[model samples]
Target chain A: LAKTTQPISMDSYEGQEVNITCSHNNIATNDYITWYQQFPSQGPRFIIQGYKTKVTNEVASLFIPADRKSSTLSLPRVSLSDTAVYYCLVAGGSYIPTFGRGTSLIVHP
Target chain B: GAGVSQSPRYKVAKRGQDVALRCDPISGHVSLFWYQQALGQGPEFLTYFQNEAQLDKSGLPSDRFFAERPEGSVSTLKIQRTQQEDSAVYLCASSPPLAGASNEQFFGPGTRLTVL
Candidate 1:
């Protein structure tokens, strides 16, 4: 099972692009990196997912290097409402998809 | 379309009390999952069901924690003799059966269980 590690917390100004990186050095070959955003009192929402290279959606972009050991979640032009916890998960291994403490992003205006 | 919905929104139970949490997944969803999220922690996978069959339940903390999806759409997670350690937000998620693709799981607002 691969374990993910990320910054405990981060602060960014509004209207700036925010990038949070997660490291999963022991990720397996079949594991795919997925990112989720969670707000207070709600469940986590899927942000972006990718296996290699980059994957972008309307909300965010996920950049995964070739080695697949690390991935970055980029939120363009973050707003105060973007403040939340972001989790990076490595799925597809024998272990169930688990979540770490995640990086708490605080977007300040 | 309606996303996953959990019943009661919040639950407060005394220690040793039994409580049942409900989940209604999106229509036609083939997969359902349950998770436990404690304060200042990320959600932890509890169990997973593919339609009517429960495929994985290794994450269940103990025998007191039980879950069932009899008809394949609605699920119920029952905690017997609840402990303070079980106090947390119980989340339910579902994903479509996208063959060979890693389908994104949609989550519910979750039922916050506070065992005092």
Candidate 2:
């Protein structure tokens, strides 16, 4: 499993774009980047995933550079509801995964 | 329920007692997984089942923890002789297992187990 590195917390204002970056310097070639959002008392929800380059979904965007050494999760027009802990999943081969402490994004009014 | 469902949303167990938690995966999901989440920490993989077969259980902390997905849909996690450290949120996720691809996992609300 590829160990992930991310900030412990970040602050963002409402209607602003919030970006959280994750560093996986040793990410495997077969590995993919996935992001999950979790609020209090709720299971983490899948936000977006990407193998390389830029991938956009209805909720967020994931940008992975060519080397795949790092990736960024971009949330556009953030709202109070978007405040949650965001986890980056750097999956390796096989059936298991390693999840590290995610970056908690606090959206303030 | 349309999504993955876990019963007894909250469970408080005393030390040395046994506790059983249930999970119902999505209608057609072929893969199920169990995870343990400690306070302020990300979820840790506990086990994984492909249909009715338990493929990997290396993540389970000890033999005291047992999980079964007999029919491949509904599963149960039984923790015997619970300890204070057993207190945590147990999460269940299900997805379709594919070859050489990333299967997005759909998670349940989770069962918060507190052992006193």
The candidate that wins on DockQ is: 2
Best model per TM-score: 2
Report how large a share of the reference interface contacts model 2 reproduces.
Answer: 0.58
What is the interface RMSD, in angstroms, for predicted model 1? 2.4
The Cα RMSD across the true interface for model 2 is: 1.9
Interface DockQ per candidate: 0.60, 0.64
The 10-residue segment with the lowest total lDDT in model 2 chain B: B95-104
Give candidates' CA RMSD values in order: 1.4, 1.2
- Score residue A55 of candidate 1 by CA lDDT: 93
Candidate 2 Cα deviation (angstroms), residue A68? 0.1
Q: Could you tell me every candidate's TM-score relative to the true structure?
A: 0.96, 0.97
lDDT of 1 by residue, B1-116 (tens): 57999998999999999999999999999989999999999999899998989988998999999999999999999999999999999999998875122558899999999999
Model 2 chain A: lowest-lDDT 10 consecutive positions: A90-99
The sequence of per-residue lDDT tens digits that candidate 2 reaches over residues B20-95 is 9999999878889999999999999999988899988999999999999999889999999999999999999998
TM-score chain B for all models. Answer: 0.96, 0.96
